[model samples]
Target chain A: MEIAKSLQQTPSSYIREILAAASDKNVISLAGGLPDEKTFPIDLMKPTLETLSEMPEVFQYGATAGYTPLLNFLTDYFQLPDTHIAMACTGSQQGLDLIARAYVNPGDKVVMEAPSYLGAMQVFGLVQADIVTVPQTEFGPDIEALRTVFYEQSPKMFYAVPDFHNPTGVCWSLETRKQVAALCEQYNVALIEDAPYRELRFSGEAIPLVSDFCPQHSIVLRSFSKIASPGLRVGIVSGKRSYLEPLIKIKQGADLHSSVPMQALLLGLLKHDNFDYHIDTIRTLYKSRYETLYSELQDKLPEGCEIKPVDGGMFVWVTLPSCDTFKLAKELLKDGVAVVPSPVFYPQPEAAKAALRLNFTNATPTELAEAVSRLASGLAKAI
Target chain B: MEIAKSLQQTPSSYIREILAAASDKNVISLAGGLPDEKTFPIDLMKPTLETLSEMPEVFQYGATAGYTPLLNFLTDYFQLPDTHIAMACTGSQQGLDLIARAYVNPGDKVVMEAPSYLGAMQVFGLVQADIVTVPQTEFGPDIEALRTVFYEQSPKMFYAVPDFHNPTGVCWSLETRKQVAALCEQYNVALIEDAPYRELRFSGEAIPLVSDFCPQHSIVLRSFSKIASPGLRVGIVSGKRSYLEPLIKIKQGADLHSSVPMQALLLGLLKHDNFDYHIDTIRTLYKSRYETLYSELQDKLPEGCEIKPVDGGMFVWVTLPSCDTFKLAKELLKDGVAVVPSPVFYPQPEAAKAALRLNFTNATPTELAEAVSRLASGLAKAI
Candidate 1:
């Protein structure tokens, strides 16, 4: 029948396509950014779930802002000022979605990194925003490109993954983070810093958050998906009241509130003394997987292919000379291995055809090596 | 700060305003449609939670379509056809919101029952849809009005709560249900039947769902919030594949999927033979509260005020002759009772000013009586 113009303009999730291709029982999936299920902290959560089940309020309707204790815990943990407001989201993706809803009008300009999180791009597209991309360099988004776009477009918001960006394992340099924040402030654009991978760092010193540089102009999204549990779908969006108040209002109609039992379970985990130890364990596990995948790709890939060095997060972005990653991805699937084509991440199609993203967190060390060898063979055929 | 045109046009949730006014603990709240916490199946869910906590898959990222077992269970429970597809939402509110996203373009016409669910109205407003209303008669939406709007406006969708409608507490006659389906099909408009209160019916025979009459042209939203647990936030939207597929695709960007552990716990409860018994207890509780409220209003209210007859569901719609319910509501609040003024539900403000909605399910029978006495006294002063 008649579909919304926004829905008509929006494309189905590219990640879902990759997921469908990787769903075969025999395939080794390095396409999805899923955390290792073996490290889900089930034993730790059993007692927490038991305690939560006894509380009737845990299963009753809760405040749309979120479970109070969890919000308090996040505010305290982040050391946010009293002027800042924090709300729980079903996931960080929802946090991004709400921000887009609160600020981006149809045909409004939204500036984002070229190879950014596909989910965020999908959200902007769904709202029918005119997305302008700034090419991302090794350290972060190209500051000059951002400045030029900001001056030319006066975009409504700038969305970035400052810490260990999705699809590309690139972390912003501390100077670049501050500069990006300063430029957004200069242009009066709201900044959305997506930090889902902040805690997954294996090496390199931590960069200060973009919000830390411009709290008044930035909204930071944090998630428990990588470190705690994804299935629970818990995340947070913290920002100044002017911006956050509208997002909270929109959130009420979005889902009323995130699930209360889910929030209580997260609150329980955050209250536990050994929560940091659990995060450390996760970091150690992913660090090993990252090393295995990176080294195997370097040793196995054909000559014209290049893998970027990554300090943290689930994915590694690889560039292949004279290759269409979408075609190569399909060819690789025939070899029983799956990786995401980079075109999904780019707003412009032409810039995305030569690169592919490989997630290192879901597969084992041995599986990573085998998947890479298979990918190399597939690449040879495609080239 | 540049805000979206849609958000600029949308008003904040009216329930939030009522909630803010009722935040004072001294006020007896008959305003919110919250389920009684005592009726929540806490003990029934304990064993379920224990089993879910032990399973790592419950905490891992789940299928965007939903947890398979839960989907299968719902399909069988509803006796849905093979051509129908079902997906889990964080809550049925989300199901409504996604439906709006999938179909209602900015400036597109939407036909809905007058004084419909405020939450649904807010969603359509957020998407900038042009909402056209059809007035409610004693039996259902005035079919003549609906037909006129359908032919004149050709609205994208018709949103209705056919069974024990919200705000009005009126169920459509079987003839009306079939008429709604036929009219929608005739005009090529999709029907969204929100059935959150279906299982909470305490009296009267259940009318067949609208989808039963026109399977391909209708989508049904069902929730566990009222009958099971609102805190768990579980719900489903089932419809023909064409409509459902787009909703699922949009759902991926709207929180990915409903929480898996929450769905698993629901599945566990469904598997238990006594699940219907839990729902029966909820119905019995509400039935008592509704009777207490209706009887008290009839005894205490001034001659000009009238309470509609309600067979089941949580609310009773009260119409006051030549008076502002908003002013009456404020006076009642001063007397320590809270109710939702009806203007929030109506698309046209003037139409809503003479009515108010009282929720019968949240407070005890004694509390309901006390609240009604206070409301009647306040009305006496206002008139």
Candidate 2:
């Protein structure tokens, strides 16, 4: 059968193959971007679940925009500007997909960081966007390079993770965030600020959102997947009404609306007085895990290998001196450790073949220590 | 800001405007495809809710393919062939959207019933497919026209709701179903069999699925939205592994996966011995409601109006000889009744301007009677 040209262009088998290998019972999987399930607010959710069980409306269809209470609560919680509108999504992933569908025509140019979120890359690619990458310089997308891509390609959209970016765990510098906003505005490009990890700060002060800098041109994507519960699949996309109106319509055709019970559960949690306390608990747990993974990698990785310090979020990215991370990832499966090779994150795989991403949040500290030792053993063989 | 050409092509304001009017407190809505909230299996779900409350895995990230247990259960329940694979979707709407993304390339010809599910049309439009619609006869799409479209346009895909099709309440004759399957195979076109309402049959013998006739080239979409709980947002798409493999990859970028807790709830219900009994109860209730609507419309509608006898599903489609349903829908809103104008269902609105769809399942018999009276009054004004 003939498949869509867009589907044909996606990186279909590589990630699935790695994920399949990671699923082996003997392997310690540090590859998946999953939050630690132990930190999920089971106790806190009991009341909400009980209340929802009695409410049949929780099991009925919701407005395509979202459950109204959740929409209102998120709007207030985020302190969205007067010009903005918020719509709930099945997940932030759906939010990204909707944005791509609403704004990206086939072959439209979409700019991104050198190693961006593979999920977003897949969505853009499925829409048949011409994905152009700007290098990341420890902080975020290289702003100067972003300017050049904007002028050269006149891309329709620029997607960035402003805080605790996936795979790399690098937050944008405040100045870079401002420059990105300005560049998008100057080039008349839409800025997609994906902030799934924005609330996951373990160190450094909070940075102003890219949407704050370019409220009119930026659409900020947020999710409960990291701090609340990934399995519930609740998230939101907030932006100027003009952009959001199209997304809302596209979302109607996407899934009609998000799961109403999940939306109600989230609404109940958000409305609770102790919601912030629950988030604080999650932050403390992830922070400790991050520290454990950082120290273990520092002690175990080969000399000349580089590890970037993470301020927050689940992953720790490492750059090997001379290794093929994809090949190493496969070899490490035999050594009983699994990490995501960095090529999956890049629009062009050959551009970054030596880095790998380790997810520290899902594994225990003891497992992290053991996993790092196994990774080191595999790296030794590869180098 | 510039939007995608596809989004621009969609019917953005028309449906929303009607929905906004329907939402007024004074309006009695026969417009929405909502199942009655009172019929939701809250009592039956108590055990499942209790079980899920204790399972932390319910709140953790699920496999991108789906929760494994649900996937296995659905595959078995559907009695899919060994060559097939099943993947969970947020809902069947997402299933449709994914099929379009995986198969319908830009300007690729897609054939559908003239008055089909507007949701499917929107998804196909968002992908910029050339939508060539076949006219719907009472028994389904006109087989002769479908064959002509197949031979002439050589469409990439053919989307059909084989049983109790939306907005039309038409089930395909057994021969029609077989012919649709054979034609799709002969033309080398993928067939999307959306069967959300297949199980809601209150009359007539069960018709074998289109996939039953042509399993290799057909993908069948099933949803719990009609039979179980719409709010939970769980559905499955099953087809040959060759076709499903691409959809599974596209689903990875769609929303990662459906909500895990929702999947578990559905799994629990499907496993219970009383599951079929619960569906029987829904069928009985909807059948009575459908009868109520049919009778009330017969008593109230003007001379020269036509109504199809629904065998199952929530809708009763009406055709008026001298009235425009869109204008009548607006005028009826003033009399406190709301109905979905059928033009939205047609690819070309001018072709079906005199018909409308009324949802019988959500409203009570008394409300259905009252809505018909109000509709009659509005029709009087239009005539």
Candidate 3:
């Protein structure tokens, strides 16, 4: 049977293919946006995992939205307004898929930074949305270009990762946050704020979410994978009840509900006394790795290669002289360093500039140094 | 913001509303298709739960298809052909949703029996599929009518639950299964075999799956929810690689994958030496409860109300003399026995026959007898 027209339009994921290639023992992979396996707070979660057998109710079917105890806790944990609510998903990726299915129509325009999260692009692409992009500046998406697109295209939504953005690790400045929120409210575009790396900050103090400025006009997606465990496959989506109810309706057909045991386990970990400290440990570990990679690159990168220091989050963006970054990445992979090329992150690959996203969280300091030596050698040969 | 046009056309699930109301302590609910909580094999899963912390790799991100070990285990467990492969989903429900998203385009014809699974209807509805229905008879679907529909409608697929079918506990006769498979092959309509209740049988000898006759032209959804636990939210979908590749693409955006820890736990339970004994225990327990409900209804249902004997499955359908079933269900709810009305199951509600679906699982034999007493008194007053 032929596949759906909508699905036919979505190119199969390139990251999945590259990740598979990078998994060979011969390569050191910084290609995936994965939290380190060692960072998972299993000791903090042990009490809940053991307690699950005693709580038989969680093993039964649960409410379509989420487990009540988790939902109630998140409402307070996030300090949600009276009109707002929280729903759990298998992961924040599913939350984005739900938002796309619930709100987007074929040909509906969706705005995103040019170099955006690959997973978000895939979700919106599956719905056949007309994805529009604005160039990214170090602060975030180019604000002027964003305003012009919103003013002219009247897009349905703007999807963004404001706190330590993926691919570039460019957190939106506070002024830009308020401005983007205001623009969304003015344009009647829903702001989808994905903060999977929000808690991974190592150097800078935290800032307010863009959604904080316009709560009614935005939805926030939170991930615990960085702090807890990705294998639990649980994430939270919060917004006003009106915005979330349709997601719940779609979710009923999606999975009935996410795993109740996972949700309950999440709630238990969030309530644990050591949970806050666990986040700090992940931050310090990632920070040390990030600094090691940064200093190594600063010492070794060739002429015309520029690298930006990230305050928090998994990756650092390296800008190279215009060249075939894909070719560069292929050579680098054979050189035994795995980094994602810039084009894969762009909705229109041809429109992307020459750059690469290198992750720091998954590799050890010594491996980070070795990978940079391979990266620098490959770049010198290409440029 | 307006919901997507497709979502707007889909009705909110009435089953969900009814199930919520049925949760009242005063109501003896026959509205939900829930397995008894006592059936969950927690003891069998305990050893695995304690071992999860040691296996740090399972806590990391997994392949989108599933955890490798679970997929390999299911491949042999299901005795799938060398050409076939298995993938995990949050539930069989998500697998169905993925199939619709991957295969059905807007306005594409999809076929089902008149009274079908509500979740299936919702998934198809979300895709804006043109759902065409054929009538169902005691043996399964009306074979002649199915052939006519297949020839005329040219539906992309026929979604079915051939064994101990939902709402009406009518297991398809072996002859009907063969006929349906032949017609599907002849007409080139893909057969989607959903077998959540296939293992719940208590008395009858096992029958070959409808898919077995048309493996190349079918996708099979097998649920562990009824046998292990629904809260795990893990199910298996198996078919040829070509048939399953599109679903994996859609599933990449759905949840990346289902909960890895849950999948691991399920594998452990399935491997346990006593797992088969646990299923036999559930079968025996449910069979006893089914006997009580069947006998009570057989003895006490008002005149003109016809109750069919079910070989197995969760529900028993009661055909009533022409009347308002929605109103009848409401009265039964007030009478302290909650049962689902028939119209909710129909794509074209007005065309449905007056009937009620009474569940035989979840409630005890004593409660089932009392529920029947209440149902009989209420029917007498109404009819």
Q: Against the true structure, whose DockQ is highest?
A: 3
- The TM-score each candidate achieves on chain A is 0.98, 0.97, 0.99
Consecutive 10-residue window with the lowest summed lDDT within model 1 chain B: B10-19
Report lDDT (Cα) of residue B183, candidate 2: 89
Q: Can you give the TM-score per candidate against the true fold?
A: 0.98, 0.96, 0.99
Candidate 3 lDDT tens digits, B28-137: 99899999999999999999988887888888988889999999999999999999999999999999999999999999999999899888999999999999999999
Instruction: Give the candidate number with the greatest TM-score.
Output: 3
Q: Which candidate tops lDDT?
A: 3
lDDT tens digits by residue: candidate 1, A310-349? 8899899888886677777888898999999888888886
Q: List the pairs of residues colliding in candidate 2.
A: none
Stretches of model 1 off by over 4 angstroms after superposition: none
How many backbone clashes does every candidate have?
0, 0, 1
Q: A1-383, model 2: which lDDT tens digit per residue?
A: 77788887876658768778888888999988888888888777778887777888878888888998888988899999899989999899999999988888778899988888989988998888989999998878888898999998888889988798888999989888888889988999989999999888989898899879989998999999887899999989999898899888888888989999999988887777787998888889889988999998889898877898989988888998756777778888889998888888999988885888999888988999999999998887788
